[model samples]
Target chain A: MKKLFFYTTLALFFSACNKEEKQNYSNIAIYGHGGAGFESHTNRLPANSFKSIQKAIEVLNADGVEVDLQIDSNGTTWLFHDQFLEGKTSGNDCFGERSTSYIKTCNYNLGGKIFQLQELMDYFSSLSPKPKVSLQVELLDRCIDHSLLIEQLIAIMEVNNAYDWVQIESDSPGLLIQLKAASKHFQTFIRAPDLTSCINLCSENGFDGIIMNNTDVSVKDVERVQALGFKIALFGVASQAEIKSALKKHPNQIQCDNIELLHRIMKQ
Target chain B: MINKGTAFILSLFLFISCPTFGQDSLSSNIKITTHFGYEISNVGCYGNIGGQINYKKFGFGLAYILDYSDANGLDGPFGVATTLSFSPNHSDNKVINHFINLDYRITFHQRFCTFDCSQKYNKIQELNIGYGLSIKIFKRLSISNTINIGWYLEKSLSDRTGKTISESGSNSLINAKLNYLIAK
Candidate 1:
């Protein structure tokens, strides 16, 4: 019993540290995941928040920020990415399906406050025109009422006068097309499912740009898409080496978990 | 790489069983051992069922760990699976035995992840050399405890958004396992 207790204690001791893995730094201008915050994965800083976005711009100097948007049953859209709040937050599995009032009470570690979409848009619109931070928002199809989601989304963007600053991206072609049809002024970027589709979608005239996963398409593909006269962004880069490889494409934007390290590497 | 890995394993087996060649006092026994244990560095808890063929002072072991379930009872641990073991039973003493365990595990980890909420297991192969003590509680039933110095090789496909990627790394850990043995 003593030995078992000792081993368990030792295991707990190691777990409590939960040290963030170190990556070799590089200099790169990219989209910051959850706003370039540290200790956020296990809920130190909430991803897709006002504070995280500000941190991304001021601290990491990210040119643009990508945030995830999901709606609750109360028709209130939130700045959360995952299908389940339990994934990163200290919330339970069914937390995603719960009412907004219940969600507001739950604590998400260091992601202290949850900001809804209208408020986030209001905050950004309040900012002055100088040194404006580009915003790329991804829609979570599963989290909201499917039929009314796009309608409500368009309403908020139009109301906040955020059309010029926002570039919306999603894997759902239906949503992308719907957003384009609903608001001709708003920028819509199609998140191509693969390289073939990336080329195919970029070839079409509707989208302002194409976003591809770093692993799916290479530098050559990026060049091909750019030749078709479409802007390109590469996301889902988890390491410094991946950032280095993706930078070879010279993409218009790249999403990275460690932008500070990337900038440092670039400075070197 | 697969061929080279297979070759190394074959060589290891031949080396482990070399001492029993042409020996007559060697006895053959079959053992089933269940291992319910946890791995450190937040690797999670795992349950393993091992089969071994004992010949005199040596035994070759194979174990399958069930770690894929979403619900793992109490702690809900996400652990790793699959291992190979070699037991060098005591020829000099009756109280203890020496062991060299070669483990091939699909380790589900957050550390070596792509930062996505959903994660998959990466391949981890480890070799642990340790000493074990066995207590025969009843007929055909015994319990054993082993403490090992482990060296591991990690090679697996990454959870990529667009394409699958191969990743590799290495680490060392100190581990212990408590196993319940049923023999025939």
Candidate 2:
């Protein structure tokens, strides 16, 4: 008789606990982030100046980002995407014009100055809603400098635990392989140059996110890749239609050259 | 012996009081009530009392409830609502009422609140199955008090969140209503 009472009481207690847990899981919202203009453009001011990107992000209610961060010849990191700064900056062809020290004074004609990787970290952490905007630092210069870049970026991320909000991405297979060895704990994206390769690489490396160019990729591609439960990121978006279409597919992030249009598309 | 006697008396009192503790006679009324009463709860609360014109088959109501809390938030939920009630004898005063209701309180659209991970709003629809007593006070006016036990499902819902957030628990509503019949 005592055993019977004990079993019945235990059953009721567990049933109540189960009911409470079910109630807690009913409120999750899966929001998307990113559009074009994440890279390939120069800030007319200090690279640490978050005005353009912040305003661009405001429209999308973006929670994640796949941005381009370039490491200059002098070992300083700034957000840049173009191979040359001729028309983009002050028309000086500043890509190989000067060392990192000299370019710091050149003002890349993008209205902003170059921002150290640390400045980006500080700006992101101070936002009110605190965008979960994960970064996909694109390695532009391939002089085997990713080791140093990873070390610096991870230091900032680890100091703030910003790794939770940022994911490192690179198109180079060699760079990705190096990153895999350097920091097994940090999430990395293998930015596929094409769809066929995206599937092949993502399948092997077990990438947490995929960063792709928006020009060739369609919304269906975003949907297909996202269906695999991997986060989708659209790279190289220059048109409003491309950005809007990818937004419909709800990619995890969109990397683009036009920040103003990306912001407008997000609002629409 | 004395202690045993005292314990016996206490048990006897508890047994007698148990049945009489809860509300007597489950009287459910399918009345379209425009409540001008205080709305107070986590979802939202206000106090704006109103009345309802209810017939045997349908009910229409208008209510303006105000929040007494310092938030000073007020809501005027004015709409026509219909109630389907099951009462065996419509003319009888001491009748038992059972009802299921879908109450839609309209308001400005905003981000929804959810418990845990699932989002749910206050457009709560209740499928209640309980017994209550209906007391007839006047010619066309009657007073009813009831405690209903049921689940509040989403009513007039636009968004379907894969599953129900809260399961059927002790979602019991205690209501005291005076209903007037417009026609038979």
Candidate 3:
């Protein structure tokens, strides 16, 4: 009986050391969420910061990045996430309530400087090899003039020649409609709350795709959405298990918070 | 606020120094043990340190754990655990002792926030039940391994957006411990 126990333990130890099966993830695109994600404590760099974005693209070698863009009072787009800047920065008002001069002076309590959308576009245009990375920009609609915001965004895209590599996402159907009307070259996606709404919105409005939270959708839901001919992207993944589950759903893209984990898993 | 690790360590020493219950005078049946181990769970792995007091077939223990799984340095969640165990063959004098246990742990997860920002603490309470076997390896040292199924109850404070991220679920934990008999 003792020998049996010893041999059983030995066998289990060897089994644990066996190589894990490698999975093929060539079809899935990995995008860093708000640069590297919004972990309150785990993230080294603040989300939506230029440093985080640069690390996600240049160091992590992610497929692309999903950033939050808020239009200030001056109608210049800024990369920010919160509806109000009081908690994360020294500023007290919303981005739309502040001008370019005020926004530029306001510093993130996390140490990095707040950046303009133009800066990100300029960085992309300046890349010599033109890094093959797509940028999915989510519009944080506050108290801003939608028409002016759209016009300014279109001008930025045109000046940087970013229409082909940049995609826009928003929860507001009205904004998407205006964008599509303004430019046929723009690729728009609806940030849907559910599978049914996603399908209905994409099919009804002729949106290019849908973006949903990873936890809100299932494997079958992803398959069903893809079966309907609309691309799907899942976000809010933080751990290895969540990443693996998101990959299993086989969404066209994943806006991951843990870019390193996603990159390692994809390599495996 | 007192440091969580320091408070737990102080409490552990106080618990060890307290006299045993009941005055039956069979002092030999009472045993004090100190243990250090590694625990692996679905969420992450932790380094565990604690001590236990056993009387006949029943034992009680307290442990402090530090998480070491993620790349965020040692800023991962730290936990305090209390366990009650029953060993049916504790007095059999055999080389192996098999036990069943119920464990409750509370882990504090700090939210990401900037310096001087009002940081929120997310607390996760977990209840676990498991079986373990300890084998005597030396005069007063033994090695043990336990496998547990934990039901985690998570309560998260709101983020800057006033949205709470809920991660309530069940996971498994496996522990390997090296124990020393301090008193018998």
lDDT of each: 0.55, 0.47, 0.73
Least lDDT summed over 10 consecutive residues: which range in candidate 1 chain A? A36-45
Q: Quick one: best lDDT, which candidate?
A: 3
Interface RMSD of 2: 23.3
Candidate 3 clash pair list: A40-B111, A40-B112, A41-B112
DockQ of each: 0.02, 0.02, 0.03
The per-residue C-alpha lDDT of model 1 at residue A67 equals: 74
TM-score-sorted candidate list, best first: 3, 1, 2
lDDT of 2 by residue, B1-184 (tens): 2222233233333323333333234234433332223333222233334455445634444533333332323111222222334444454444444444433333221212222223322244334444545666665566665455544432322122223332112234444555554333
Q: What class would a CAPRI assessor give candidate 1's docking?
A: incorrect
Least accurate 10 contiguous residues by lDDT in model 2 chain B: B72-81
Model 3 alpha-carbon drift over 4 Å, by segment: A1-20, A128-142, B1-184
After superposition, the stretches of candidate 1 with alpha carbons farther than 4 Å from their true spots are A1-29, A37-43, A93-96, A129-143, B1-184
lDDT (tens digit, per residue) of candidate 3 on B1-184 = 4334434444445444443334245487788788888887654577777888898899998888776654332335688888899998785368899999998888776553222235456677778899999999987899999999977766554322333444445667788999987677
B-chain TM-scores per prediction: 0.49, 0.41, 0.80
Deviation (Å) of B123 in candidate 3: 31
User: Against the true structure, what is each candidate's TM-score?
Assistant: 0.50, 0.44, 0.59
Q: How high is the lDDT of residue A52 in model 1? A: 68
Better of 2 and 3 by lDDT: 3
**What are the per-residue Cα lDDT tens digits for candidate 1 across B40-107?**
32122344444455545555655444332222221122233444456555542344455555554554
- Best-fitting candidate, scored by DockQ: 3
lDDT tens digits, residues A1-268, model 1?
A: 5744554455555444434445433333367775653332221346776656655554345655677777677777777766777756666554346788877875655546666777767665654431233344444445457666677788887887777777787777777778778878878778757767755664563877787788888778878877878788888775667766776778877777766445534443
